[model samples]
Target: MTSMSFADAARICLTAKYATFSGRARRAEYWWFSVVYMIAAVVVAGICLAAGSVLPGILLLLFIVPMLSVSVRRLHDTGRSGWRMLIALIPVAGPILYLVGMTVDSVPATNEYGPSPKAVGQPVG
Candidate 1:
């Protein structure tokens, strides 16, 4: 797997690739960004609880596009269609299946999306 620093991953997902859904994302890149996203969400939730304000919700809305785009790229890394993200719309089993799919390692080399992010010297973004 390709190694990606948390900062680099966050930078790529939150800025450079904020709405980019056409490329592959390495496991490190995806997970690191996810970690940061979740942390911010938790913090926002806490602020919402403490302040009883809708601003937190609005703040989270800003992340939706980046998160969705990163998720699509992550799926592409696994050689799956970005449309597979719709699977999450299903009930219980759907979320479980979706999580499992995202956890799968990137397909060896590359299928169609592009070259493997794991390829030597491949940049995270």
Candidate 2:
């Protein structure tokens, strides 16, 4: 999982169905994708800030959702509901809660979200 590619990470995110909050995350699979997403966002935001034109600026500003899609997927991979993202709106408590939740490892076996992602990584039984 390179820090720049979105392909594999996107697949992992899509396959993660439930949000029960359990299991281990493959560090590279999740973190690197996050780094790539953040860096791209910063660059895009900078471009929008530098551009003076309103329409073009707004156009450049529209990448937020697609960019964060992977993060949402990562959350799903960790068995977290995508709606949990709304926590960002709660001021300090919001982000703190999100951080706490996102930091928790995945449930050990099956969770509300679906089967264990770890099972997919191991040799077949």
Candidate 3:
């Protein structure tokens, strides 16, 4: 696989890995994708508000799975189970903990999820 830049990783997450819940995502990949996701949400909401129609909501729905899947994979990269994503349900602490999880660096070596994405020649799984 070709080496991926931050932009490429974000694009891949939105396209190729749209609903890929299994596998690992590098911190860079997850963060970059998140930035794009937020931007898209803002844009879509603006369009929906301006148009005064529910149609644009469909676009947001389309992204739901990809967002969740990438979040799960990001947790997996930290050697955590996808189910752990449920922590986001708690009032304040949950979101804070989840943010910490996403911000931390990946394990230097492979855990149960797979090889380290930082490994040379290891494609982002």
Maximum-lDDT candidate: 1
Query: With candidate 2 superimposed using the best TM-score fit, by how many Å does residue 44's alpha carbon deviate from the native?
Result: 1.6
Query: Per-prediction RMSD in angstroms?
Result: 1.4, 6.0, 2.1
lDDT of 2 at 82: 70
Candidate 1's error at 18, in angstroms?
A: 0.6
Candidate 3, residue 59: CA error in Å?
0.6
Candidate 1 lDDT tens digits, 53-96: 96777888888898899899999999999999999989988899
Deviation of model 1 at 7, angstroms:
1.4
CA lDDT of every candidate: 0.88, 0.54, 0.83
Off by over 4 Å in 3: 1-6
What is candidate 2's lDDT per residue for 1-125, written digit by digit as tens?
A: 12323556544433442231333344345655566556656676677668843444455344344335544644665777777778878988998887676666756577665564556555211
Q: Alpha-carbon error at 67 in model 3, in Å?
A: 1.0
Candidate 3: TM-score?
A: 0.89
Question: Of the candidates numbered 1 and 2, which has the greater lDDT value?
Answer: 1
Best by TM-score: 1
Candidate 2 Cα deviation (angstroms), residue 5: 7.6
- What candidate 2 gets wrong by more than 4 Å, as runs, is 1-7, 10-28, 54-63, 66-72, 77-79, 120-125
* By lDDT: ranked, best first: 1, 3, 2
> Which ten-residue region of model 2 has the weakest summed lDDT?
17-26
